[model samples]
Target: MSPDVTAFGPDFPFGYDKWLGHPAGLGTIPAEKHGAKVAVIGAGMAGIVAGYELMRMGLHPVFYEPGRIGGRLRSEPFTGQTDIVAELGGMRFPTSSRAFYHYVKKLGLETRPFPNPLTEAAGSTVIEIEGQKHYAERLEDLPPLYREVAEAYDAALEEGARFSDLKAAIAARDVARIKEIWDPLVDAWDERTFYDFVVSSEAFRKLSFHHREVFGQVGFGTGGWDSDFPNSMLEILRVNLTELDDNQRFIVGGADQVPKGLWAHAPAGPMHWSPGTSLKTLNAGAPRPGAARLFREGERIGVTDVWGHTELYDAAVVTCQSWLLTTAIDTEEALFSPKLWMALDRTRYMQSSKTFVMTDRAFWRNRDAEGREVMSMTLTDRLTRGTYLLDQGEGRPGVMCLTYSWMTDALKMLPLPVEKRVALALSALEKIYPDVDIRSHIIGDPITVSWEADPNFLGAFKGALPGHYRYNHRMYRHFMQGEMPRHERGVFLAGDDVSWTPGWVEGAVSTALNAVWGVMRHLGGRTERVNPGPGDMWDELGPVRLGE
Candidate 1:
């Protein structure tokens, strides 16, 4: 960030500022008349872990990222010519995550460890069904009505890996039993997207009963999507005994050094990072009683911006990608309620893409033999999107890899035309390596984030279907709605859509440690309610049916 952020003007980095740091159970708010004036909105990683717990309570928080800050879990700046870190975007971090390994041991950082970056499955992953292919290698290789629908897709991923003791046995006002059963069993097993779960699964099987891209050749790790499974079998059972590939590490240099270390202890002139400035509207009920202003992208919220510049802070925590709250901004009808803006206008998102290559593990030890895919493979090709293993340690032979593109909503929107995005990355690399020969290492061309072509992160992570946490837990519970009791004091709401497990990064660091224990119970701090974790992690794909 050395001075040249697009010749300045929302380009940031001339001492690139962004303020609002301090979290780890918050501590800072102590300067004025109810001085805890936060504003946080998408600097990613759930607005950098709820702007580091609202600038450690001495509250003055002010982040607002329109772009760049580890949202797609980025990592570029082409480090020292390749020991390989060019992780152009998020992948591998689910090492069982005990509170994301205590936020990487409270930011000392370094989670490098891997006994098996998943190199096992070798053959038989063939499935087509009606059109006919089916091969079978395990779940009785289907055909008993697809092995009773592959035992109900491994009992919907073992009831989406046992819901933290049914969300610590509900009763947070019965979180409506996560809309009558953990949001449709986590969108019918891992956040919906197939013509939106057409009752009793018409098809899309394969959870290690082979074929249907052999769980994308045993690699494309993440979970749910017909049944893709193998984001390293939940990273070999979340890496370290309940999640640990050394805390799925990242951020020694980038992952935007976690909101540049929460904008280096933020708290100055309420944060703002304009960037190609955009947002345009969101007014919501006159100028008083529960406020909400915004404006910027094409102006006019407070007549082209200014309720004192989009109302600084009496209340406004946005933190983007709530389906960009229905395209960038604008919802009126009192900013919320009409059943919360028709549940944030039918909120839906799940389409992803990530490509970064520097290659030279001798191009995966000469692809086959020699190292026969030294582990981590998955590439059954729906335009080949999950190819893993991005090296970090050992005599390092310059190898960094990541090409995720899982269902990238037909090429993520916005002004395209670099030769039609290099012919859609040469037709998604001829549907994944068809006789190789992609005119020499391709380099730059595969950047199609398509979370519905951004109206602001309109869903990629944080999906949740079915009853989706009982009707989108009030759009990720942005520290619950107001009625003024000092507008719900110490306000909080981390993301990955407030959890009972929302789209991962361990439910955005377990909803930023449940908003640093709700701003330490609004600075009178005290929490004793964890009851969520492995707890019989999922008694192997069996009981717990409640179908109604």
Candidate 2:
């Protein structure tokens, strides 16, 4: 467990944390470019991060958000209860997300270990699969079959991907070694699915079919990943290699506070803005209406809000889900190359739904007659693929995410009302905890989210499919606009979708930094010689290009 193993890329291994912490600051814009208005579409993590950096660099970032400012980092509070919240979006944050935690530390927000399965924070875990239920305090306490499944997956990673060596390389930040092992993996696994990798592995070949099934249901980190079986093996490898799933934590107040904090936080000494100037004040306390249309306005980029208010910006960073450009916003075709447009359109997003309920207390902590806790953090093959119990501490109300499912499982509840969804989840939990009366402990209206149903976000986050590496490479490298035609250079993309690892806040934060670099360079600004940005290291450390 080397401290340096933080999401220092398997693709494009640029140290974003170091870049952000550099005393020289991000970069300097020319006096003429000072106060230049840049339209940041969608005030999500990426948008806020990019806007915050741009503002620090003497640029004025005018945010256009259709919905709330926090985007997918949504934290919905229970009715009449401000402190308690349902983390409808990114609830878990891994310590490896050095760049994301940079802001978290800056805001002085408190965090505690996420109660992932088999961890001390979870206290206990219950695994239910194929109608069989098992309770355990840790992996060792589970049945032998469970241990065999876990070992087979670990052996499979080592057999196929050389897991140990590669993880060590990442931990050491050995740039050449990382690319040496990872570049070939991209070529080998990009065209294959995760299920393909698991089934084809020599290690799994030695195990029973039941073992593989268990591996999918009770994954190594977090919970089930069967929903992601059809995704590119390269995608899964990136998550494993970077340790994105392990050592997870959750924000104390809420995940949304990070973005909201940045929105109101003014840099100690911004280049052009006054000392008290902040993004909140820059936009006069609220963001402009959601961007309805994006088009080129001669040399500048023009953004039309939902209210028909059009404004031109020196540069624009589109931080919303890439699909929104096609489904929600009317983006001009000329702004992106045909190949780039294809990538943006082809970039697949995963569907996700979460049903949460506020509870009377941390009642799950009570032990039953058998001495086992009344309820535990749950993973199952039932309707509730994963159930998390969030303890707000003794004497305080707790929150329970009754169900967190993805893809097929998530879509099953897409059309159902919140009440019906809750009922369905409770029914599923009842089967697992036969003696537990979950509904009796309920305290408030349940909260549910079907990300795909929202027009602003066509899906939760990007989940690359087999043979989609070219698309991902195209989107990820778009920030290096030095080679691009002038018309397409000013408008940039930033979000988890445009990053190597989607569905992680680190991706959003890292790509946002890329956009900040792109915008700075687009505006005739340059990073200090002492601190080169992502764009500055593009040629040597950019993602590998695969043949057609």
Candidate 3:
């Protein structure tokens, strides 16, 4: 008899690492296939994690990175500073990213609470809108209208989707309850934008657009969720239902450490590698040249790098943004079916921009004449949509993320140089705290990133638009190509874009593990007698296929 998923109760299959160790975890490859090589393109979180784990299982996983190892998780230190650094991508992470955190904890990295607005770490927040400022130590201190918006959001969630019950079902791994709640939601909300959900809800409809505007400007959890308003409502619901935006924390030194650490970490008692082998030591301190072309060669796959050096591998995992397949590389016509190619071509990426400067110290923490700090975690309607302050230590130097923006807000700053971006942000902040001298405290040159402007990455991350659920479902389920023809079995897609929650690292890790399972199966692996892979239980717990 199949194991009863309901018996697991509250112990869901979401734990990627746990799933690996579970009786029903990934299947194992036979010893004869253990030493076969695997090619992993892109050195991002998904690539690093998947490669490391595969290496532990006795597979020789070679990586191809056009640039640095930490793809989008870039943390740049000041030129002359000892430890002060600016986060150019993925600054904060929520605790719910358990799969990603598994490696973080294993590597023994320290993390501190991120100062999201209304959180205690924030100390205070200034919400600026409509040329007015309101300072609050907590959410309750905000205007009654703001509170009403917050309450209305909760009521809408409860009324429209049985939020509490769905959450309970998810927590319990109650697959039946989950499908009953989620399948219907996917069918109803797949064609609806987040803006539509917010405006059409009975609770939000009762209030004027002013309340909606306030909610847009100063959203709960993370500030200014308006950038996501135009995307699918299912996207928003997935984020909230999974709590991807809550309980966030910053890696103490840098978020890039997650990927960097994985590259050098030696898992305890790894199979074929020596006791101290790492991805770095395994590759002789360098990655294979960047993959420039990919195609099928008989039963195996071939990848040719920029230098025209070609190598054949038993299986390949593509972890970069999917568009690069067509734009940056020479891909064969038959490698991916037309439908899959369409999904890759149609992937919509959201734009993002961030400007940062190293400060002499956490000077913003200094008390003013009125016995209040000069500034706090700030959210505003101005060009600098969100500002975050990072405290390095009590008296040591620190970093300030002057402006982190998305969507149209991100597009507006795309053309500006770093110095001008910093200047523009300072000008906006000056209006909120006319008393604070933001320019005088800067100790180093400013740093900035417009992800959309980066060549290797065309955009920050994927944001599913309304009617894009089918595309996402198709991309995410591509890892299950073992059931496809032999030619398609050797190539796997793994990345945040190929995940349900496109922007969250958890999704990246989850999808990468799925690809690992797919690779194992393709290479003639089998689960232990008692253990079964996710594919073994697809009907009970697989993602709902709407309109199928």
Candidate 4:
């Protein structure tokens, strides 16, 4: 059962990639149910993916979106530049996200290794802490303190989570071994914080407070994870075990293309629709207005758009941030059990802000007097937590993500305008590279996004807190509705927030596939014998349940 290091769950280890790639074609719906209308709320990645699959299965999926199509996979182009754009959200896609890559390949989209901190793709990295800066092309180039911190984290993993053995089981797709090791971890770490894990570890206990602080700032994989210090250790462990933060890449043109492509693409051979039928054509080109209300109207689900146009459907798939269910939409109380509602309402979303500027050229690639890059990928403790340089090409204008910050750091810029945000970021970077003038190279109106400020998205994505494993478990497995009361059967939840690995696009895609299965099954459809869907394997491979 050796599979790719995919999003195959440390929780629900269902191979969504396998189900998608199978020749069986995601199962078949009864001919009678072919044209059944299924309301898909939110036109984000999860919504678009679920809508696309349901459309292929012969069901008519009506989309409702408050904002743009891509959702969190936003690629905001600089003024007057299409190809050169800023990835506002969900920018980095790890190689382990096999399910997500499946669509990237399907759309023939080009991807390049994301310039992560210390990765060769970044060319070079600069770590700055407390007004002290250290430049390095690799880990070894830094001082011994950096190496010791790295080694301490590695040792801590081996000590705390059986890192090596669990990762091996995951890569091997050994479901039994994965559960045997990971299930118990749910109970052990679900109540603890990531900060607690490091402080409690023998490796970090021996090191000074500075080492732990360094580990949080210039953390492994992307950048500072200090924002996630208060999050559950189980969340961080899932990321480590699945390699969600390693070997990442970004779509060449824009990540927005993936969801837009899925929306416009005509599957090779769809179920009941004509050969040229697509989600774009089915709903008369654009999606309905944002879903303002969700309720069950006499066995069928009803979704009322903002414009007051209500539509009834046999089933509905909700892919928006869970908070919307309570805040934005008037979701009927009877639609879900009290426990499920608590999970949905209590789900915590983290704040994130990214400010990107289009440069006149790839001037950062220029060398300084010391023959080093003038400006390298930066990780600092300043207001700008992480800064990435996006080199378009030698002659082409480059997109510079001047600052990417999360949680408290993100909230700092939430109230500031784009100009102020850019100015603040420049002020911070000026201290690190005093000689290089970043503002001088700026070419276009700088773009920025504080996801929390956007009414459509309350926050960037879910960041599970301690003791919230039960909440996550309830939401992630809500797709399996066999035993649920009939009143709650018609509507299903799908989104990154509804998954164990929130904030990762892979989780969004995986959960959407689950909702597709749930919708299919609700519509009286079943997968072929050769390819069992997630629902079909639920009892055998569901996520480990934590006792109350």
Candidate 5:
């Protein structure tokens, strides 16, 4: 029997590894350029994937990370606890993010369906707003008012955006069709906020402000998307159409394992190094010091480490957050155009906070007097906002993400310590399940994170405001700098923030690959007959810039 290729999906989208293995994908560089060194900043998934692929193409990529290799793919396990964790950063990923799954499958990693509200894995859900509680196993179980609002949302998506058609076009890689559908929407919604899109729509107009408020508090997929209300409609569409908010799964151990695995993985072929040599071995098991400054000297780009040591590299891919260029690092003004710098400076990020706890077991699984789990994956208008439960199985320790909030909600918990945050979350949760003593089941100290408090990352991820597409277009296309004037050819940007879908790992991985393509060209290489990079399909697949 033929192998099941279903996980790869039906449209047979861009084959990342297949493209690499193809003859057309091979030998992009001149023989003399083999093993030439390139600088890769940030050891996140983007940097790691780019470095890994560059190594396969016979280039040596030295990575520099200020902290750990995972970047925002951080999974914090409780102290002395195994099989339980708090996902402090990017957690769930959709299957449609194929490029990301390619690495996951290659590393022999396991994944389980994320317990998103209303999904089968979610079991049940509780949506509480204004002191009224509604429990359901499905959307239909909600009050008629909510059902009307849900129907309106579905209708609006169909009539206003042609959502299903757009999703299909993207799935098929029918770039022309995608552009045909997406371009007009960008023109229509680029200057509008998600809230504007909803209120102005025929469906939402008929609904009451209270209905709108309920929808804002407990959205269908992963609690409220209201944090995204202030962002451009185009941003929301990119997320929804690409399935970033649906059919998701969590990496079995930890999401960070993906990048960590790639760092140590040894490719098989003429990599110009030993057969079993890996990035870990090549870097001598340590990353270069964090870069404190970057500037163009004579021909190559000069990078200064935090220790004030400076070195020059032929090319550099900066996967760090854009704000660092101005705030955390001293980058030469001449490296990027004034326009590009403006875009980087204008990039806005959303603040996010999460509080998680380790429990002895899946205590929530314990049946109540009514013969149901005491609690469900929760969504509420209260301070806690959203809560998710994770089961490690019958006997192993389980984890509960007590609260996940963004923007104003996140800022509220910023000043509090971890214990206080956990206490506040429990106090709020107790109101919903008054009979249950949530604090009693805890097995270890709670873990909490306020991304805005972290110096390395000023915020969680980019949350593009209305009229921000031009800025995004500039940043996303920074990899095309080889085509720019001589002064702007070396420094390239790649990260989730620079991608169209911020906070999604697929964006990070895809944009990183885009940077790899750019770096190859910068190093005097070109794609062969069939394995063309994103630039080759630029006209069809390029982002829809505002006022284009």
Candidate 6:
């Protein structure tokens, strides 16, 4: 009921006539030409949002998803009741993601206020010592030296309400309050991702006691620290490791269910999905039979495949792994060079392991003393690559828990056989939740995502490196073009990687919305689309640029 008119305000779906053009069951019907037929590659949020925009313009879109519809926007329904709806990809976001809010509301979907979980938990901070982890009520328990500096530094950082998140607690001397609001590092989408946040943040400079917890590198003091990782890599590690944000909301079932609902409601059009398929090449020069540019066709880009397999399209888009986009051919000058690709590789990524341990629910379901959902316990690990929980929708129990979401600077070096990657995940879990009855508890690990080992994605995402603020600005400017603030269209690129707000659902949504708006404006007759204010962080800093 609520989504019927998302951005339409108060109540929506006002008049379908105002929104739909052309004819009924006919956005897909070909008529004249508006110039070029758009081709969106990669099926993730960026690609999907682009496709959705094209269809809304009375033009058809041939959504090309080399894999399933959702990219990192996926779920593992295998363990069914046990798997706990593990979202191995983009997690949740806050009201800060304006486009997401508009999109959800415009679609007229049900909306619920997400109750913050950190409320009930007695612990909001954790520290790691010599690989061992422990939680704390106040950061005071840390070594006297760090406790002195960090506390002093933490004392100064303020969150003005106008600043997206206000830090009244810092002024009020409320440890619990600050825990709920402040992030040690800035959240910016830059080529430097998390790598840039660390060395640059004010908090890290003051607090060095829990360096591992703050920088999150596996074996930091070890040989893994190389002259190679001087700037971006080390900086990203520091920022992401120490940065934190907890504003939250989620759909009823698994997160993917929300997108599925969107698709089910989309006006009829050409939607293609081939999960096991891989894009061999992007035949740009050598012409194939039929549509020379099926990728930009009406609705059926009848473009031929590697072996002369042809297909049609009204507007075709490739929504496969982004690395594939860069690695489409065997030529040296294909998309990006191997060194460039290798440089891309050294960027950053997220790795996770989830074991949906189904327990006799209803037990942990009780609202705590303060009317909050009880969180059994949360143990922080210095080496938890990249991990967190996806609050399943109403009525669904069990934790969609996670582990080890990190910028894989060190991991890329390890030679992981498929079995080893799987084993590493289990081992990491064993360390986190030692109480689980290994054989009986885990129902055969229904799902595991070792992006490093997966040849397709190379790595899940690219973390923001040092000085990413500059790089991000350049990317967004170069790609989103319009008469507005920051609009770069022609080279439209969207992904968690491109969005300096790396390793989270927020960036993905951020990337998609901008791209969607750009596509719409290109076909929005003559009305220019506005660059949705850089939501939050508008005045704080511009997109990270490379050379200052």
User: What is candidate 1's TM-score against the reference?
Assistant: 0.30
Better of 2 and 6 by lDDT: 2
Error of 2 at 210 (Å): 1.0
Q: Write the per-residue lDDT of candidate 3 for residues 51-88, one digit (tens) a residue.
A: 98788778889999998988888989886964567888
| Top candidate when judged by lDDT against the true structure | 2
> Tens-digit lDDT track for model 5 on 1-548?
01112112111134454554466554376668788888888999999988888888888888888989899999888979654679899889888777788889989999999999988888888888888988888989888988887787887788789977777766555656766887788778889999998888898888899878877888777679788899998888777676777788999889999998999998777457779878898789978889899998787988898999888888898999999999988999999999999999999999999999998888887777877778899999888999999988878888999999999999999999999999899999999999988888998789999999988899999999999888888888888774698988888899999988889888888788888888888888888766777766565456665654
Write down the lDDT of every candidate, Cα atoms only: 0.40, 0.92, 0.83, 0.92, 0.83, 0.40
TM-score of each: 0.30, 0.99, 0.96, 0.99, 0.95, 0.60
Ten contiguous residues with the weakest lDDT in model 6: 7-16
Candidate 1 — which residues are off by over 4 angstroms? 1-44, 47-256, 265-376, 379-387, 391-465, 475-480, 484-490, 499-501, 504-548
Give per-residue CA lDDT, model 1, range 1-548, as digits (tens).
11111110000001001111122222223344234445555666766666555444434445555466667666664434522455554545544444444444555555543212222222223333223433333436446554554345334434443434333323132333433543344334434432222222334332234433333333222322432231212212211112222224444444555444444433333323222211111112111211233432221122112123454353334445555545544533334446545555555555655544444333433344432332333333344334444443344433333345544423542345434644554455444445544435444333334444555565465544444333454544444323424523333445664443444555565456445444534444332222211111112211232232
Candidate 4 regions with alpha-carbon error over 4 angstroms: 1-3
Ranking by TM-score: 2, 4, 3, 5, 6, 1
Point out the worst 10-residue segment of candidate 1 by lDDT.
7-16
Which has the better TM-score: candidate 2, or candidate 6? 2
- Model 2 pairs whose backbones collide: none
Count of clashing residue pairs in every prediction: 37, 0, 3, 0, 0, 71
Which regions in candidate 5 have their CA more than 4 angstroms from the true location?
Answer: 1-27
- TM-score of predicted model 6? 0.60
Model 3 stretches astray by more than 4 angstroms: 1-14, 21-26, 529-531
Tell me the TM-score of model 4.
Answer: 0.99
The true-versus-predicted C-alpha distance at residue 172 of model 2, in Å, is 0.7
